[model samples]
Target: MINGAHVIIYSQDAEADRAFLRDVLGYPHVDAGHGWLIFKLPPAEVAVHPAEGSGSHELFLMCDDLAETIADLESRGVEFPDPPEEARWGILTTIRLPGGGDLGLYQPHHEPAYDL
Candidate 1:
């Protein structure tokens, strides 16, 4: 069985991205050798939505309180996709990552990928 998968993001400002993931998102992570940082992310839900020529990875994270999460992030100077909308299968919102890639925040309507 597949245990888990780690999505690695390449950023020009890797340190800043690491801090954002750990500080802003409040996810526990570690800095590996050779200037690589690994984030211990929650179980994956959404699949990778690759952008043409961009190579950006899109992930959907399950949240307990979408409203509260959004509020807290916004207060911390994070710019979320204006007017979050409910997609067919989930709530979709976009966040700007440090390296100009868009991060998707989603609360799926179907069963969550992991237990809350």
Candidate 2:
């Protein structure tokens, strides 16, 4: 039976990234001891899109309000390298993470599947 999913982000500066996730993003977490932190994410979902050629997987954090969410994160010292772009799917932009990484965050235009 399929259970929940666990996503891992490999970071060059793991401590800093953990700090960013804990302090800045404010995702409640527990230490696995020795400073290893496991964060609890908000509700999540997965969708598959067909591609022509082989492609890698990607992760995106979905939100309800794009502007408001961006404002809140920005206030927490998060950086957005590009402005949000509107598409049929949603409004999206990349949020800069520690160690020169980025995470995809978007406000979805489609109906959420949380009820299912």
Candidate 3:
């Protein structure tokens, strides 16, 4: 029975990346020092390695507005691969995370939280 887990981002630019996550996206985080910064991420419905420029799993965050989320992320200096695209499953978008990880932002087709 698993309760909680933390996703770690290994970044070459640790401090700047941490600041980006905290200031731009407004995610709460704690600096542990020694090349590690911990971000208080939301509950995980899915998991993946977000490392950019490497063969890694994709990370997606379910958001309210696909366009707004994209815009906000862009404004905060997050690089998106492309514009939002709607698919049968959800609205898929992309962003470059602090640890050179690729972030996929999506809004699911069904309201899982509401249903459960």
Candidate 4:
């Protein structure tokens, strides 16, 4: 039986990213070994989308309210490179990670599977 999912974010500055996850986002994590921290994500869901190619994936953090979540994150010193845009599925924005990468954040317009 399937139990859980483990997501990995490859970063140029792994330590800095780890600190951001720990101090900024406040995700509880356990150090695997020598400071390799694995974060405990909130309830998660997976979906399949059609594509021309394979071997690619994405990660997006869901929120109940985009504006409120943005405000809360901003107070904690997080940055969003762009404003949120409306989509058929949701309103979405990208969080500028300390590792020089972006993580998707969105408020879903459709029912989310994580609740089920």
Top lDDT hit: 4
Model 2, range 1-116, lDDT digits (tens) per residue? 97888899877788888999899988999999999999999888888998878967888888999999999999999999999999899999998888678889999999878657
**Candidate 4 structure quality by residue, lDDT tens digits, 1-94:** 9789889998999999999999999999999999999999989888787888675789999999999999999999999998999999999999
Q: Which pairs of residues clash in candidate 1, taking residues 3 or more apart in a chain or in different chains?
A: none
Candidate 3 backbone collisions, by pair:
50-101, 50-102, 51-101, 52-100, 52-101
Judging by lDDT, tell me the better candidate of 3 and 4. 4
- The best-first sequence of candidates by lDDT reads 4, 2, 1, 3
Off by over 4 Å in 2: none
TM-score result, candidate 3? 0.72
Q: For each candidate, C-alpha RMSD in Å? A: 3.4, 1.4, 4.9, 0.9
lDDT of 1 by residue, 64-102 (tens): 667778888889988875567888977777777765666
Compared with the true structure, all predictions reach lDDT values of 0.73, 0.89, 0.73, 0.94
For candidate 2, give the lDDT of residue 12. Answer: 78
Best by TM-score: 4
Question: TM-score of every model?
Answer: 0.77, 0.91, 0.72, 0.96
Q: 1 or 3, which is superior by lDDT?
A: 1
* By TM-score: ranked, best first: 4, 2, 1, 3
